[model samples]
Target chain A: DQQVKQNSPSLSVQEGRISILNCDYTNSMFDYFLWYKKYPAEGPTFLISISSIKDKNEDGRFTVFLNKSAKHLSLHIVPSQPGDSAVYFCAASKGSNYQLIWGAGTKLIIKP
Target chain B: EPEVTQTPSHQVTQMGQEVILRCVPISNHLYFYWYRQILGQKVEFLVSFYNNEISEKSEIFDDQFSVERPDGSNFTLKIRSTKLEDSAMYFCASSEDRGQGHQPQHFGDGTRLSIL
Candidate 1:
């Protein structure tokens, strides 16, 4: 029973274009959502997140949109850079204590 | 920015041997968790701890596995008798609290354990 899922295994986009990654959840009790970017041989680094109350959250070039009714969320990176190429994992936490349901991760490749 | 830290970036242990993985979560964070990922697999939650007690744990956390916050700053995961299937990258993450959008968890570099 995977509560969180990223259906796309990988995505490719040109530099300076937009890269959108999607995620869905089955557990309605999840109140908070998070994104993490990981590179080879390193731990996942925290990215942006949004609460179920909000529709969107943005930080610099990255943005996250959450639709509670749809039980879905997506991450958008504008003007995608080569540096953004990595495995992006979408995570959701129910109440607290940092327990997260993680997706397998979507690998993004930026074409120059 | 305070971040989680793990020691002995890599460990190779023989089957049936006891192994302890250490971690130091962010100072102000109130929650700590341990997760593991097999090569090319999704990260799986193991256990979460708060107030010196386990808040939640997955089926993966069997009787052979135990967690302890021995002192002020250290969180450890111990495998009493590790098996070959125990080989994986163990990650430690910390969050300030739950339900807050800023509750972004910071993760350690992870301890990669190889069981032989």
Candidate 2:
């Protein structure tokens, strides 16, 4: 079920530049959204999250913007570094449910 | 920082053989989960465990699959009869709580299961 989608299979950004990754969801019941970063062999590492109640949430160099009306969300990484190169996943949950619906990941490559 | 951990970085099992995957969730976390990802697919949720019982499970979690918290520290997933399609990377996760304002679930470096 394509409940969540990350249209871009890969993204490239220059070092010290900004990187934007987008995600869209078709489920209206989803109220929580999260962005996770994963290395080749490691599991996903939680980066940032936004609740439907808010439009934005920021953490250090990472920021997540949510547009509920359009059912879209994006993750922005400012001053991207080589260490930021990894696959990113967008996940969503509905109400108090613990099950997370995931999107096909986007591979972000930060060039030096 | 506390993090979830899984045993046996990779496993190879014969078809129809039973295999069990083990995980140790973060201490103090009340919720635990199991998810799997095939080579070219999105990570799919299998089941969520809370208070020593399953709170929710997906359609993929059929009669062949079972989850158990046999001890205070370990959560396990057992597949009664393995198939070629069962080969995938299995991940374990834990969250401090669940609700409208829920905490993020932390994952471990997954265990790769290969059915031969």
TM-score per model for chain B alone? 0.95, 0.97
lDDT of 1 by residue, A17-106 (tens): 999999999999998899999998899999998888899999999999999999999999998999999999999988555578999899
Q: Pick the candidate with the highest DockQ.
A: 2
Writing each residue's lDDT as its tens digit, candidate 2 over B1-116 gives 89899998899999999999999999998899999999999999999999999999999999999999999999999998999999999999989876525688899999999999
Q: State residue B57's C-alpha deviation in candidate 2, in Å.
A: 0.4
What lDDT, from 0 to 1, does candidate 1 have?
0.92
> What DockQ would candidate 1 receive versus the native complex?
0.65
> DockQ values for all predictions?
0.65, 0.74
Residues A30-85, candidate 2, lDDT per residue (tens digit)? 99899999999999999999889999999999999999999999999998999999
Least well predicted 10-residue stretch by lDDT in candidate 1 chain B: B96-105
Q: Measure candidate 1: CA RMSD.
A: 1.4
Chain A vs. true chain A, TM-score per candidate? 0.97, 0.97
- For model 1, residues B69-96, the per-residue Cα lDDT tens digits are 9999999999989999999999998888
